[model samples]
Target: MVKLSNTEIRKLDDAARAGWLYYVAGKTQDEIAKKLNISRQSAQRMVALSVSQGLIKVRLDHPIAKCMDLAQKTKKSFWFSIV
Candidate 1:
């Protein structure tokens, strides 16, 4: 298990939202956990917590093809890298 701070937990909350979105979109918990660099159990728990905590909304928007695109672009523009 990994130890996390309140801030880190909040970040994980965002991750939880993203992970839940992916899972609800059909990806497996293992896949989401792998992507998030955590355990499958953590992924499932966080995703569920996000839903239980009302941190995420279940909306069916057209898959935003530019979501990751904009993320990458913002990274480049701001010289902020993830990883």
Candidate 2:
């Protein structure tokens, strides 16, 4: 992995916080901007940057039985795990 300077680290932290506020806290860009003491456009960019940097992850949780069945079938067909 590449090392980040303090400024870059600070920006990534801000972007991650903005993403959490918008996605997890259900805040709008305007709200995030106000809460973070940044401009709305900057907040938008931060959220986008967070996603682009893979700082935000989305998962779909399926029941174990369904997931297991799907995984088994996929493995049988493909001879490898897709999960």
Candidate 3:
């Protein structure tokens, strides 16, 4: 694998964050630009960079997954449950 320079690393970091904000947080390009203090065009470019570089991933989570996770957490936690 090719090593990234400091500038490249920073760019990738920005792209990853922008991609997450867009995909995960459901932020628009304009919102990302406002939050990052960059132009909307730059925000769109960063999101595209993340996809081109394979920084984003997609997975389907089963609805029961959340219930199972909660069960595990309850098993470990000291808190009392009302249910």
For each candidate in turn, the TM-score is: 0.47, 0.70, 0.68
Give one clash count per candidate, in the order shown.
Answer: 0, 0, 0
Ranking by TM-score: 2, 3, 1
* Highest-scoring model, TM-score: 2
Better of 1 and 3 by TM-score: 3
Give me the runs in candidate 1 sitting further than 4 Å from their true place: 1-12, 58-83
TM-score of 3: 0.68
lDDT of 2 by residue, 51-83 (tens): 999999877676886787788898999898674
Tens digits of lDDT, candidate 3, 1-83: 99989999999999999999999999999999999899999999999999899998766599987887788798679576635
Instruction: Name the candidate, 2 or 3, with the larger lDDT value.
Output: 2
Ranked by lDDT, top first:
2, 3, 1
Give residue 82's error in model 1 in angstroms: 50
- The C-alpha local distance difference test score for the whole of candidate 2 amounts to 0.93
Q: Which regions of candidate 2 are displaced past 4 Å?
A: 62-83
Tens digits of per-residue lDDT for model 1, 42-68: 888877777776776666466684686
